[model samples]
Target chain A: MKISEIGEFGFIDEIKDNTLFNPDPVVIGIGDDGALYKTTQGMEQIAVIDTMVENSHFIIGRTGEWYDVGYKAVASNLSDIAAMGGIPTHIVLSTAFRPDMDVDDVIALYKGIKDICRTYKVNILGGDTVTSQEGAVITVAAFGEIEAGKALLRSGAQAGDVVAVSHTIGNSGAGLDVMLHGADGYDELKKAHRFPEPQIALGRLLVKHHCHSLNDISDGLASEANEIAKASGVRLVLQYEDLPISEELQRWAAASGTQAGKFVFTGGEDYELVFTMSSADFAQLQAEFPAVTTIGTVEAGPAEVVLCQGGKRELLPAAGWTHF
Target chain B: MKISEIGEFGFIDEIKDNTLFNPDPVVIGIGDDGALYKTTQGMEQIAVIDTMVENSHFIIGRTGEWYDVGYKAVASNLSDIAAMGGIPTHIVLSTAFRPDMDVDDVIALYKGIKDICRTYKVNILGGDTVTSQEGAVITVAAFGEIEAGKALLRSGAQAGDVVAVSHTIGNSGAGLDVMLHGADGYDELKKAHRFPEPQIALGRLLVKHHCHSLNDISDGLASEANEIAKASGVRLVLQYEDLPISEELQRWAAASGTQAGKFVFTGGEDYELVFTMSSADFAQLQAEFPAVTTIGTVEAGPAEVVLCQGGKRELLPAAGWTHF
Candidate 1:
């Protein structure tokens, strides 16, 4: 059945029925003007919102399933909360639906959202749904909590801090290219693109290890590094040889005759945590998280990012995906 | 200049400059993955999201100014919080913009949002801005706080409760008609449609007076009353003659040969609080809020609504706006 037949309230009722995972802290959930929830004393609140527009963020049934679209929408917002060094507790979802859209696809979208929230122990609070004239738009507002004055910020990096990333990068961008170009093989790359995991555990570990600065690789490593450098008023020098590139991504790029570094620097939506800390802290963290890799160092200089390769140095432009 | 010239981050910088009205609770504002704020002890949190799409909620530069669109977007969410008997504290705005759109128009929209937020002493947290393939889409997620266990809900109206509204209704609907049809007179009605205020004070007062149930009128009286009736499992009987219709609306309906009651029952976007309470409590509330009008009563019956006029009664259909 088309969404037009079900109407706005009917669709909302469907969402209400499917949502409500992790409802312990929730006094009110869906079917209200606003949702009410209990707050723990002395804890700081973190809120973030992310929107995924159809045809721009994803092409339904082409790039991935509607389920993937829903899953990624929640993942993106959760990643933001993770970047803040917080534990996500609840989310509110807002959507703009086209009248002629199929109801089953929308339900699948909610199923994906529900599954993710359930996995993360996050409650679906409330959201708004309205009719749109064209493609669907999904916006998720996520809320998390952190200890008082313990949020990880981009402006906390100091000179002599070591820069590290949670895991290998550029796989998501490579996966997108594989889907868009319809290249055969590389199932792992495709899965990386379709289901990028939020680095919530790594973020908490970084905070516990006293990491000074943090950012998520949503707009590529280049842009995220620049953001940290500018916010902290320090320079970041990345070793090109040390940049973490997955073996699968390297093979896919080499087979496709593409430069792997291009995806590493400019590819977006990797959903990995890039952070800075002292060398001693990094050593302790790397012992616990064996996959974490150090690729850069902070220096006392103008706010900038530089790449070093073969004893050569060059400035890195803040080039990534520009929405406009 | 078009937004495409400056890019997405550039537009975000402009918004970052204009926001930040109340900064006491904000630990981290804009320019981050997520915003952080301190939560007060012993207070519950409230969250709601509302979206406005071009040619759907309002026609920019025609039905209202871009500023009004922005103002109403925040007002709608604020009204939701008010219905829950909470004090709005922070908001995150998410917009999907057409790249070719003029930057000045978007700035005006933010100006509207800024002014309303300033009036309410609410802080602008952070949001996401993306490129849409079509017209502008604005979604605002509002956060508020109320005392523990004191939020007003829709399912609390018991039998023998009186149904009341905060103020006159149907003016906004008449105003929209005037603008859509290009009628010569009714400037007051036009203003009503352009700038509807959220009844925050009345909502707080209702909670103070121990009102049983509450809802905001966004989808007209018939629909909102039906929601309350169904949620509370009680029947509502509204006296047609007792609905608080503004004199200007009555004049416009008479001049335009339209039924004023039609607008009262089926028109939406009034943003007034409609609630139910015992007659004794209602008397106490009415003494302080003279503008509050009694139009109905809750009766022990199956969930339904009946309109009574001149010794005749008819079932009131839940016919308002159907988004799909």
Candidate 2:
């Protein structure tokens, strides 16, 4: 009867399983990455909130800059807004620090958050401050305005849509491995983990260019692709040989005794854009956005993401961080 | 310096002192009871986020029911929305719980929240769930909307305006004392603390009736009155003889060797409406809302609140719950 018995995913499912709709203004409520509320002025607004805890999400001793922690905290929420193809406009930060925390440390963390907001051209409107007997708890609520029909969704991918991933993958997973092992040739990966950049502009571009479906790459390409496939009622076939992994990632994966191809396929925290595009549009998109790589094809079948590896198609296991 | 060295209010000041506002459509930001953002549809929206930590905000072995805690959590946030004269629409709840939490117990808590939201007609939109190594952390972000120019403010009270308290005060404070005392005839007072009702409808009525310069009496009537006085650049003279104290509160205060009237005057978490109105409008309001009490008046002077007791006036001290 304890919480762990149901697990974190079960709890999330319990909350979102219902198809309840709020009164007149809310377009979408609990199930999506964010909620869509229609403004009385006929504008669609997106709101997303997420929280991160110390020692649970990040250890203080490893990658110990409070600034980096702040960046990760805000980036997590920003990624949700980006998934909706909305431009984040304002953020409210609520934090509870332990009694022993230094004032300057918290200030530096806020500064780091402000720097990220500055880079994104958003404002930190307001928040709350309270002390806790437990460790640090930070919650961020972000709001953005999106055009009436432009927000991307997980349920929009159709059969025959091509799966495309923006830029490379596995940098954060390799970075975390380096932080754990103190290994060489993975410093850049570690930085990538600490400060993952959210592709907001790319998300907007995808929505504008009529991408079939969109989701940010947070919990690995395989896991996220599986989510899109399940939500969209389609099957996905990914080409592992077509994966764009960096040379440093290959070097680090080799030193760690991990397969570079599998690392790129199943690693997480990339914060890259993984989206589905129409076959005709995909051809035109490839000629323009060279950073985008065609990873797979959507098909009408049971929801699954398979990797074409070693001339064989195999089901990819889900191996990302489960926050709960 | 340690957080204690900075103190609770000092910590809040330090956190918000340098917060720069790039208000694109922000009506009011940090330093208010809540953040006010002008919705894209030109309606005024109120958003407030607050966190409650186990052992810090409440004792684990308290006499109150878990349901009471859940209700109080939502009520506190709803009070903030009500203070801004906005109608509660949606709330996002982020919770982190230790592994020991019973699933049924959490469901009961959720039921309590659902009951209150149903009563207020607010929807539970979206939030996050995470496992905690420590005790539970509950953060609620409540959002509401009001007409563009109808949101009352603390800075709109003018000199010569009548200052009033919406109802009897200090019942929640007395209720807390009852919980700490463990035995008494203070059942109603204690219940008041556990499940305090927010003056949402009353606030809407006041705004509709053109009342100016309003705030909810959360941090004691005296503390909040002082806030209004300072924000409005007016002085407040509160007659102690006119303070409203419940009969049960008086009986409990006598047993505890405390001044019941003084507690009602300065104790916190009453969730009552406090506002100033023009003398002419005050007469009409008295006829409309007979439950309201006119306890003070605004004057042109140095911004401060004074207590008028036994024909003597003295400066009121700021004393309430300090969370740092």
Candidate 3:
């Protein structure tokens, strides 16, 4: 059967079931966005490899500058590290380039990657390259380190915990939609789509604050909330009206007759942090991070995310952007 | 300006020069088959990622069983770890598959990979999969560890060292040739092409014995020998007559009117270890490893490799299979 028929989510399930690495050192593997292993030095090693295929996850020029592609590539992996509240140290870039690609473009791509690496103080230790028959396939494998027992996980939320997001959501999806239609004048949205900033600082702060459960919004807020809920065996009740939709996304949603809440729930590639913690911790986090918005609370119930508003409660569709 | 115009060698040179890694932990990076780094635990971390594109380094059905492609993918990365004389601990497989591919085939491929991982006791920690635009692109990024200051490098050959290979050469190239042409026989050659075994035990043994410089014959004997000579700043005079050619390749070469020596020199995908060490060390290795074949000697001179036979000498062309 074709992969499109099987669907990316089903395939991910197959991979999770048959995952081959369940060694003693592996603290968590295959289920989350990244894998975690305890190193010999008593530190938790966080590893994540994200594959970005041309015309799929990214486009050569449709999204942004050549440098943006490179910047985003590293940024995505760093975001995975951020999900685990780790600091990236090493990366290996395995890229398959089209044979006829210009040498300068590849260099520019590398420069974009290097620029970000320079900013993050991570080293591009090594990588291998292959020639693709057509489009480029760039995969970045990033390695990070965190203090033992300090790395946050999805399976740690508790009942009565306050659910919050690191910042405003839906800009990336809005930006991408605008760009695809060639709509004018939303540079911030386009920038957000082109380069979804990795919330490294926020991740570190969350770890320090001892947040209960956390995951990055790579897919969508709803999907991430569901993940944390399912893994932690709790119910997440999201207040639909409380979602932190940006003014830009709000204006665009209004013009398009689309609910900003739905976009915030279903839009992907946001790269924000969705976390749950104690009310005190959430208060402290909101004070420290002015952009954070508490949009929900955890409850003792079935493992799912429910949207509550205006005396009506409904289970979310578990819908999100899957690669398939 | 196209990659084909720049050529793989030129592009590699550009990458080596513009490499973004030069940290205190990096012992060797970029230019070698794998990068070596000193970890905080004082162990040397060896990392290498190799990309195998469809119809380029491998074929879906032409190679052999569905498992051969997967087996060879992991083996290639293992070969790089072998080159460094390190013990592989973990691997991440990033594969791009055609959407029309069968789910069963993917499972079979994973089974093949799992078989090898089980044998080597290496963990398949994690990987990402993508939809291929055309054919499958399978890449393996391997990580290994060796005691600090014990890893071998292409730059460790001494002036008076004796050059040798771990086993017979040219079988993989000849096997691929036989497979490409419609031939039924030459099972050994076909096996060489399909499931090239990584010399893990041999590599570990060599490291224990303190082999000076080592490389794997992924791009033919001549190219690997040249790498050692160039990196070590020594002249390598390979006695063509002493080159180890399997009886199968020799017979095929004789029937096809191809020089067995040249086949040994230019044939690639032969996952054998090529090393240079002191003459005394070479003799000891030959005795311990009965199959070890000494084929050349390193001398103080210009950094180059020359093929010599019966007092006649000529510069060997620095040619091998490059993607471009």
Best by lDDT: 1
lDDT of 3 by residue, A38-86 (tens): 3457565566777788888777667666677888888888887888777
Best by TM-score: 1
Considering lDDT, where higher is better, how would the candidates rank from best to worst? 1, 3, 2
TM-score head-to-head 1 vs 2, winner: 1
Q: Considering the two chains of model 3, state its CAPRI-style docking category.
A: incorrect
What is the TM-score of each candidate's chain B when compared with the real chain B? Answer: 0.96, 0.84, 0.84
Instruction: Name the lDDT of candidate 2.
Output: 0.72
User: Which runs of model 2 end up more than 4 angstroms from their true locations?
Assistant: A1-42, A261-266, A286-288, A317-324, B1-42, B60-63, B320-324
lDDT of each: 0.90, 0.72, 0.75
How close is each model in CA RMSD to the real structure? 2.5, 11.6, 11.5
My TM-score estimates for the predictions, one after another, are 0.97, 0.85, 0.86
Q: Candidate 3, A120: how far from true, in Å?
A: 0.7
Best of the candidates, DockQ: 1
Backbone clashes per model, in order? 0, 0, 0
- Candidate 2: clashing pairs of residues: none
Which lDDT tens digits does candidate 1 get at residues A243-262? 98988899988888888887
Candidate 1 per-residue lDDT over residues B50-134, each given as its tens digit: 9999999999757998999999999999999999999999999899999898999999999999999999888999989999988
